[model samples]
Target: MSNFTYRKDHIPKGTACNRRPGFAMKPTTITIHNTANEKSSAANERAWLTNPSNKVQASYHIVIDEREAIECIPLNENAWHAGDGSGSTSGNRTSIGIEICESGNYTKTIDNAVMLVAQMLMERGWGVDRLRRHWDWSGKICPRLMYDGGTWSKWYAFKAAVQGRLNELKKEGVASVSDKVTVKAYGKQIKDGKLIDGTVYVPLRAVAEARGDQVSWDNNTKTATIYK
Candidate 1:
C-alpha cells in the first residue's frame, strides 16, 4: 500500500449543487472517473465542489492525486456524478464515486488510487467485480485514460492491480501475532499458536507434521526430536 495521505473535506449538507440533500447511498460498487482537468489537484477539486459559487451539480466521494486523497463528500451521501438519472439502480445511488485527479505524475496518481480502492474493497469485503468505470453507468467516455480504441485494457489492468493489493491486505489480516498467531506451513494452515507476553509459542509437533516430518517425543527427558 502506498503511503498516501487522506483527509475529508466534505461539502456542507444540503448544498444547493453537487450533492443530494435527502438521498442516502448504500454503495454496492465503486465507480471510477478522471477529473479530466489536467491542471487541478485533488485539493483543488474538493475546494471547487465546496465552493458556493460553483454551479455544477457534479460531485464525488473522493479525489485522488499523486500526493493525497481528499474526500469532498461523505461516502454515505449521494453524489451527483454518474450521468444516469436518479433511480434505484443508478450509479449515483448505488456506487461510490472516485475521481482520480489528472495533475502531477499520472502514474503515481493512479497507484495511489489503486491503493485507496483496494483498501476500500477490503474494508467492505468486496472483490474486484465491484469495480466499475464511468462508461459502465452511462455512455460517457469518462476516465478516458482507461479506454483505448474501444477497448478497456487499462481498466482491466487497474482492476487487476487493486485485486493484488487487496489480496495482500487480506493476508496481512491473518496471523496477526498479537494475541494469537495463525501459522501457514507450506500448504497447510495451522491456527494452534499463541502469543505469551512478548514471545510467540507454536506447537512444534504440528508444525513439524505439517512439513511432513516425523516427530518423536520423549517424556523421560521432556524432549522432542524431528526426523527428516
Candidate 2:
C-alpha cells in the first residue's frame, strides 16, 4: 500500500490513492503524459476513465488529476499507453504510463507527476536507466504541455530531479506492486499485454492458470472471483 494521499479534496493536492490492480508483477517503466481536454468535475473525469470504447478508453493505467490518483486499467496487463502505435510494445512488452490531466503548460501538475513517478519508480525497484519519456522510445511529442518551457536542453536536469525524488521515496519504503491476474470464464481483459477494465470482456484462461486460479463462472450471478 502506497501512502500517497491528499490532506483534503482538491486538485493540485497531490493525493496518492492506493489501488490494487488486482494483479501481481514488477513494472518495467513509467510513461507520463497529459490529457488535453479539461475535466474539471470529478464525475466527468470518472465517467471518462470508466467508459470503454471511448477515444481514451483503456489507454493509461493511472490518471493523476488535480488531487486524485485514479487507477483505471489494471497494472499487470498492459494498457496501451506508450508507443505512437503498437511497434514500441508490440510483442507483449509492458510499461506503466501516467496521464496527467491538463490542457496545456501545466507546471504544478508536472511537478506532482514527476514526484509521483519518481515515487513509483522507487517503489517498483526500477533504475534511472529505465526511466524514459515517450519521445525517448517512440520519438513522439506527448505531454507537450508538461514541459517547463519546451526547453528539453535540461533533460539531464529533469532526470536528476526525478532521480532525487525516487531516492527519497525509496528511503521511506511504502509501496506495492501487482505481478499477475486471473480472469473469469468468458471474461478477460487485456490491451495488448496490458489489462483493460470492463465487464464480460476478453478471455484470459491462459493467464488464469499462470495466476494460479482455476477459472469459473456462476451462471446465475454472472460473477467471477480469484482467491490467492
Candidate 3:
C-alpha cells in the first residue's frame, strides 16, 4: 500500500553483444543452469567468459557462489546463455535465467541462489508462480542433483521457491505483501456506512449496538442518544 524504494542498482549490468542491436529481447520460458564448479570466484567463472568461440557464447546476468555474486550481463540484452528455446525472446524473453556455480558431486549451494532469485522475481513484478528453471525448457541435466525430482514442472518448483522467498523477504523486512485497509469499524465491520473524505460516517444506533450500547433519544427534548 505504501511506496517502496527499488534500486535499479540492485540488479547488475549485462555483457555487450555485437550479435544484436537492441536489448528488447524477452523470453517465454526460464532456464536453469549449473556452472559446474564449486569455486564461486568471479575470476574462476570468467575464465570461460573471455572466449568468443566457446560455443557457449551466451552471457549470464548473475552468478551466485556461496555468499559471493557477480554481474556478467545487463538485464536489457539477449543473453546467449540458453541453448534451445533462446532463438527469439518475444516468446521467452521475459524468462529469468540462473546459473549456480556448483556442479558435479558438489553440495547444493542453491539456498542462497534460490532466495536471491525469489527476491529478484518479486521485485520484477513477476509473481512466484511464474518463476522457472533452465531444465524446464531444455533436456539438460543442468541443475542435476539440485534438479527437481518431484512431479511438478521446474516452473512450478520455481514458483514454490518464490513463495518461500516471499516469506524470507518478509522476514528480512525487504518486502511486504498485504494492502487492505479500513476507515471505519461498526456492527462488527464498516457495514453501517463508508468513509467520506478522512472522516467515516456511521449510524449512531448501529455503532452503539456494535459496542453493546443502547440508544434512546428524547424527541421533544432533543436529548442525546444513550445506549450502553
Enumerate clash totals for all models, in the order shown: 0, 15, 24
- In the range 50-132, model 1's lDDT, one tens digit per residue, is 67788888888899999999877677777878999889899989888999999889999999998888888876778999998
Give the candidate order by descending lDDT: 1, 2, 3
lDDT of 3 at 65: 59
| Predicted model with the maximum TM-score | 1
Displacement of the residue 79 alpha carbon in candidate 3, Å: 0.6
Over all chains combined, what TM-score does candidate 1 have? 0.74
Q: Which scores better on TM-score, 2 or 3? A: 2
TM-score of each: 0.74, 0.55, 0.54
lDDT values, one for every candidate: 0.84, 0.53, 0.52
Q: In angstroms, how far off is 183's CA in candidate 3?
A: 40
Best by lDDT: 1
* C-alpha lDDT (0 to 100) for residue 122 of candidate 1: 78
Write the residue-wise lDDT of candidate 2 on 111-199 in tens digits. Answer: 66667677666655676777666666565665655455666644556567788777776787744332224444335444324222222
